[model samples]
Target: MTTFVTLTAYGLADGAVLALAALGFVLIYKATAVINFAQGEFLLVGAYTFYSSFVIFGLPVTVSVLNGVAIAVILGVAVERFVLRPLIGRSPISVIMVTIGLSAILTAIMQLIFGTEARAMPPVLPRGSIEILGATLPVQRLLVVVVAAVVLTAFTLFFRYSRHGVAMRAVADDQQAALTMGISVRRVFAMAWALAAVSALIAGVLLADITAVDPHIATFGLLVFPVVILGGLDSVPGTIVGGLTIGLIKMYTFGYLDPGLADVIPYIVLVLILLVRPYGLFGETRIERV
Candidate 1:
């Protein structure tokens, strides 16, 4: 049906953004076993940076976008080096709380600088709609899906084939083993944060293009929690699957039921999935010998 087709397109686009956000979360967790509570703030930062550079300062889109991503990369590395490095041997809870604190701090900084106003991005993509099976989708939304897919594919290749990617993977698997093999665990950790930040930056720009640049952009990061959990905490592919599934569920719920239901549905599904498969669909299970 036309309704189905339309909802599916919208859902895929929405899901792609969530998947991109979740990818960043999963990357950090996968590499460093650190659940970055500040991930959403990174999204906020990237979106705002883009807005400030491109919209306010009248910079070229390409240069502005790169500046936003570059800022995120710097923040990521700074957080790792200054905030998280000292806590390396500390308890996971401490690191988590620190990240949560970091999120609050970042949010405050954004509010102070940009205020609480919602901002619409100027038309960056070609303004139009694409018709598919009698369903029309805005080009911006379509671009979000395409860009996300490409980024995901590129990251997948990087992880599977690249030397540094392999090093990160090795570190993820066993830090001690990776260190024994002369792979610098610290370097991989820094790289993981950098990669995660870059992912967040791209997702931020895409989501901003779809919605707007606002404080609410940070919440997108929070919504990704369910997606990553559904996909698996440390599973890259799982994040993508979870994001798309959640996105469809939300769109369908909004279309068939009430708009209010869309907001609650993902969490409901998250709870149900957790009850069924705690490790997620593709998450690895570690069995310890006593």
Candidate 2:
């Protein structure tokens, strides 16, 4: 029972963060029909930015967080406007390669600026412990779950009623039809990228809290690929379900089996799902005729 409680706590925390990361991936894919291989790099930048502003530069927590988020939003908008907008009608492969290259550039820049060492942030959350099922666990874990739930709920509401959210949803459904209705497709594209960055920024902060501000945080973004793919790349709700499932599987496997297997398991599940449903479990199947 103790082991189960511990594993469940860790799993839920990890899963919540993964859902945030995968949510960004799905937003960009759904809105623009482009895969962002640089998603991890965005998280990398966010973590480093926050560490620098809050710890190294000795800024207030609120300002530091806002600065990090601002940078993320700018990066996303810049990428959409300058790097990707020009390639509007290019092949998907071309866009994919561009993002891959962008990832390399972002990684190199982060390493050059921050170096490869891990930096610890001053603990922002209380380090108190709580009992669950006769097992004592860090209260921080529960707090993270609560934070994730609140953020996810806010996003859900934003999409359902907000004007910009409605525009984005329309664009995702059909760009041409949205344009016909006087929606600015370009603006929608930019907003999607901006929102993606915001989600990545939040995920990076959560990861920095769980782990640390380090290059490995970026690697966590890569792991989210499995979560997004498994849940269905274009499905936002899929992110939540898939993230929790993968998180539990990884944590329990690590506690009970080989540690290395935990990392491998999500990918294995993704492959099995892909074999059975190429468009993903919740992804829409489009029949494009030549």
Candidate 3:
């Protein structure tokens, strides 16, 4: 049916972006055991940076994109080195609270610098639409899916075979063992944050293309919590599955029910999944002795 095809297209595009964002959450958690409450703020900063460089400043798309990504990477490294590194042995709750405070700081800074207005970017993708069944799908949406797929594939290869990727995996598995093997745990932590920022930057650009750039864009990062949690916070592949499932559920709600309820659906699913599987469907269960 036309509705089915239309929903499917939107779902896949949205899901891909969500998966990208959620991957960042998983990477940081797996690598350093710190929940980055500021993940969404990374997206906010990247989107605004791109807007300033490309739209307001009139730079070339490639240059602006690189600038945005560079800013994200630098911020990630700086946060790790200055804000979090000192708290290395602190309680998880303390680190989590620090990230929460960091999020507030980042949000305040973004609002102060960018203001609260939404800024439209000049269309970078070819402006067009494709017909799917009886419904029309935007070429931009299709491009989002393609870009996400490429990034996912590239990262999969990187993690499976690359030296740095292997190091990260080892560090995640057991930090003490990795350190004993001569791996720089601090370096790995920094790299995880940097990669997470890169992923957030990509998601920010894609989502900004769909919904314009604004302070509210950062809230999309918050949405990733449900995706990561539903998929298993520590499971990368699960992020993809959770994203797709969330997207489909959202689209189904919009198509069959009220469009206004779309935003509420993800959290609803999150709650249900939490109730059913506290560790997530693909997440590993660790037994801690009291």
List TM-scores for all candidates, in order: 0.98, 0.97, 0.97
- Order the candidates by lDDT, highest first — what do you get? 1, 3, 2
CA lDDT, every model vs. true structure: 0.90, 0.89, 0.89
lDDT of 3 by residue, 140-190 (tens): 988988999999888878888999999999999999999999999999999
Against the true structure, candidate 2 reaches a TM-score of 0.97
Q: What is the C-alpha RMSD of each candidate to the true structure, in Å?
A: 1.0, 1.2, 1.2
Query: Where in model 1 is the C-alpha error above 4 Å?
Result: none
* Runs off by more than 4 Å, candidate 3: none
Task: Give the per-residue lDDT digits (tens) of candidate 1, residues 1-290.
Answer: 88998888889999998898899899899888998999999889988898899999999999998898788888888888999999988999999999999999999999999999998999776679988888887887888888999999999999999999899899989998999999988888888888888998888888888888999999878888889889999999998999999999999999989999899999998898889988899999888999
lDDT: the better of candidates 1 and 3: 1
In candidate 3, residue 255 scores what lDDT? Answer: 92
**lDDT: worst 10-residue window of model 2:** 277-286
